[model samples]
Target: MAARRHTTTRRPVLAAAAAFLLPPNPVAAAERLAFDDLYSGWSVMGASFSPRLLALVGQEAALRGYMAPPLKAEADFFVLAREPMALCPFCSSDADWPVDIVVVYLRRQAQPTDPGTRIEVVGRVETGSWTDPDSGFVSQIRLRDARFRPL
Candidate 1:
């Protein structure tokens, strides 16, 4: 009688190593932040940014939310909402966005992100009252220099 020994090759391990060397998707780097943590206070006048949001200024923050209708379909900025927005921005001039909204300023004019879509936004958390020169929309909490993609 004879006994046989089997050996495994290193090719599979090498292939796995190569796959790991590939660059990671940019969207994967966006950190998730909840709406509850976006602000500490809510009011008609203005809302205060939470401590977590304040600390993220000038840093990339990822917010998972729905897209509120833009003031204009072709506007540069759009509001990220916690829920599907029922109000139309164009229909009502007095209609205000939520206090926790993260104003998204896209890098370029692109198709609006899906209103029903859950998206992650990566941008600098800008806190202050700033008026949009193009749309004249006022916002206390903004996510400037931002980019977004559907989740």
Candidate 2:
């Protein structure tokens, strides 16, 4: 008896269906950002936003950093710093702010992770200086509607 090759259109259909069933890849979907990548240079005025960072402005991006302790146990936002900071920068003067820090505004209020804990945050990037109306916090950069997970 002669053997015949087996093929079916159902394979493609099933694969398409499976793709929809699978959860989206967060890492793949977001542009990875870094503290060192945030700036191009600094003048007497302040740090300049790097071309890479500016390009990500108004777009969804991700960055890994240490979470600074938030003012409240649970809040809608927190600060992410290159290195773990013990004190709340928000509670102090602007002079105390870390060089590599950016505000992360969460999508919802949740318990803040321990200070210095490394985590990856994903959100829409915003550039230029902006102040939080509710908290009276000023930030050069921010990640809006962000969510984070431990790295």
Candidate 3:
């Protein structure tokens, strides 16, 4: 009887095969858009959407920012700001919103969270200025049918 010996050369091939069989990463499919990339020109009137933003309209996109408090306890929308907002803009009259803030409308109701928490949001990019008929919140950029996770 002869003892069997294992060959190390097959390990690489097996590893590659296993990797190929795995599902594709969801993050790779989403186009990452930074807060800086949201605007191109700033004027006394208002900021203009960048070319990158224009091209990404109606496409899947991802943004990372702090999750501001929701407008109401039952509302499905919240504000995503460049920095952690100390006060809820919707609730406080004196809370000045950022010029480049993104209004995020969740696909489903999200649990109330602390305003200081950092989060990564994924959704379809919506460009152009539009006012939410319900909340009357005006925004230049928005993420519709969005979902988020803590960063």
Which residue window of length 10 is worst by lDDT in model 2? Answer: 1-10
lDDT of 3 by residue, 1-151 (tens): 1221233345446545644775533444566778988998999987889888899999988888998777778658888999988865577664467789999998899795677888878889998889889888888889998888775
Query: TM-scores of the models, in the given order?
Result: 0.72, 0.76, 0.76
59-124, model 2: which lDDT tens digit per residue?
A: 998888988878556678788898888655578765687866899999988788877578988899
Tens-digit per-residue lDDT, 5-73, candidate 1: 111134335435544775443444444467887778878885777777788887777777888878797
Off by over 4 Å in 2: 1-25, 87-95
Clashing pairs in 3: none
Please identify which of the two predictions, 1 or 2, would achieve the higher TM-score against the true structure: 2
* True-structure lDDT of candidate 3: 0.79
- Residue-pair clashes per candidate: 0, 0, 0
